[model samples]
Target: KFCNETSDEVDRREHPNKHFICSFADCKATFSKLWKLEAHYSRHTGLKPFACGDCEKSFCTRYQLTRHHLSHSGEKPYLCSVSGCSDAFSTPGSLRNHAAHVHHQKENSYVCNHQGCGKEFRKKKQLKFHICEHTNELPFECDFEGCNDKFASSKALKRHWKMHKGYPCDEEYCNFKGKTWSEYQKHKKTAHRVTLPCDQCKKMFHNAWFLQKHKQSVHSGERRMFKCIREGCEKSYTTNFNLQNHILVFHEGKHDFACPFAGCGKAFAMEESLKRHFVVHKPQKTKLQVNLCDGCSMCFLIHYILEMLL
Candidate 1:
C-alpha cells in the first residue's frame, strides 16, 4: 500500500532522537521539522533582517542581536567562579577565557625558570619583567660621577640621584640638609628646629619633641613637677627640659640675662656676655656689684664665670 511505503521512508530518514537532517549537500544541520530546515538554509543564502535600535547594526538571527546588545550596554552578565577574581563577561566564551587565563593559570601560561624564583604568571608581559632579573639587564642607569647604581625604571634612578644635591632647611638660625626638599622641611620641624607654629597656641619651639613636652607639661596640666610657690596649686614635669619650657611659657619671668645696651630691646644668654657686648656702645650700666663674701655670694655675672668661681 502507498501509506505503508511513505511510513517506511519516514522511518529511514529519522535519526535516533527523532530529528530530521538538512537535505543540502555537505550540511549536517539537524531540525525537528522540514520548515525549520528551510529556515536555517536561508541563513546560508545571506538572508538578514534583524537590526539594533542603538547603532542600526543588523544580524541574521535574534540570538545574535541579543549577544550584540551586551556590548552596547557594557553588560557583562556572564561571570567566572574563580577564587580571587569576580570578573564578569558579556558571553560564556569570554568568561571561560578569563577563568583559564587569570584564575586557573592554564598550561600555556609562562613561568620563570630562574633559580630561587618560583614565580608563575598568566601573561607574557609579566614574565618579561621577571626575565630582566635573570639577565642582569639594567634598563635605567644614573649618569652622575661616582654613582654607579642602576634601577629597573628611569624614574627611580632620577629620584635616587637627587640625594647628591643639598636640600634647604626651613628653620631660622638652623642650617640643615636632606635628600629632598620635603624631607628637609620635615627634619627641620621634627628634629632640628620647629619653624611651623602651632595652630591652637602661637608658641614656637626648636622641635616637635620639645613642643609636645611643652604642651603636655604646661598646657595640658597632666603632670606637674614645677609647682607654683603659691598654695593650693598642683603642677609637675617629667624632666628639667620640660620644666624650663614651662617657666618660659607660663611664668613669663626674665632671668639674669637682660638687655645691656641702652634702648636695645634684645636679651643675651648671660649677664657678663651682655656686659662685654655693651662695651661696644657709647655708654653702659655702671652698677658693678662685687662679691664681699666668697662663700655666701656664689653667683657670678655669667654661667661660665659662676662655674669658675665655684
Candidate 2:
C-alpha cells in the first residue's frame, strides 16, 4: 500500500481482532485501540469536541487539548535530563524527539546526493530541506499580508512569521535582534562561538554579510550615495535601503512593532531597537561559582543553583 493509504492490511489479515479500521470513505486508517480509532475518526468527521478555555482553538483529541493548554500557562514541564544542555519543551513527544535527534546521534540514513555536497541527515525531511539549499528552491512561502517572502523549509517560514509578530531572542542577556529570521539565527550563533573577524580592522561580525558590509562602508570608503530627500533632514546612507529605513523610522514615525511578551504593550520604531529593549524583560540569571570537585580547587559556573538550593 502507498504511504498515504494508512490501511494495515497485512496486520489485519494476521490478527483481525487487533486492528480497528476506519469506516470513513477511502480513509482506511488502522488503529490498535478503540480510543485511537475514535480519535482518528474525528478528523474524517470534522468533529473537534475538546475546545480550549483560553482560546477559540479546538482539538480532535484530549492529548492535543492538554498540549495546547501549555501555551497559555507558559509552562515547560518536560525537560531534557542531558547534562550541560538546558532544553525544555511543552510536550513529552517534543522532549523525546529532541533527546533522540540532539543528545543522541544515530547513523544518518538520508544523504543529499547533490554535486559537491553530501550532507547526511537522520530524517528524510532534513535531507529534503538541505537539498533545497543546493537547488535554491523556496517552496515554503510566507502567507502574512503584504509579505512576499519565501523560505526553503517550514521551520524558516515559522521563524519568519515570528519576525512579523515581533518575537525577540529568548536567549538570556542577549539583546541582539534581526529584521529577518536568517539574521536572527546569525545573531544567535555569536552566543555559542566566536564570530567572523574583519581582515582590516579586526572588528568581529556575526556573518560574512555583515563583514562585507563593514568593508564596503568603512574600509572601501563607499560614499553615502543615498541622501535623504526629506526637507530639513541631513541624514545620508551608504545604500538606498538604509536611507529608506531612516525615513520610515524618523519621518513616518511608524512604531507598529510591539513586544510579543504577554502584558507588555511596549512598541518600537525598529525591530533592532525592540530586541535591545527586550533584554530588560528577561528573567535575570543568578550566576554563581560552585566547587563541584572535592579533590581540587576546581570551580564551575552554575546558574539558578543558589535558588534551587534555597
- TM per prediction: 0.27, 0.29
Cα error, residue 90 of model 2, in Å, equals 0.6
Deviation in Å, model 2, residue 124 alpha carbon = 10
Give the worst 10-residue stretch by lDDT in candidate 2.
291-300
* Clashing residue pairs for model 2: none
Summed backbone clashes in each candidate are: 6, 0
Question: After best superposition, candidate 1 residue 150: deviation in angstroms?
Answer: 66
lDDT of 2 by residue, 264-292 (tens): 88887655446555655763542333323
TM match of model 1 to true structure? 0.27
- lDDT for each residue of candidate 1 in 1-310, tens digit (9 for 90 to 100): 4465554356456544546665666555676665566557554443445566554244656777789787656588887676667778889887877877777545467889889887888788778766877898978888888888877666567688778766756456767778786787578556863264555577655434344434543466454234444345455544333344345445665454677457877664333445555644543554443332243322233343332222
Off by over 4 Å in 1: 1-13, 16-29, 32-39, 105-310
Clashes of 2: 0
Local distance difference test, each candidate: 0.58, 0.66
lDDT for 98 in candidate 2 is 91
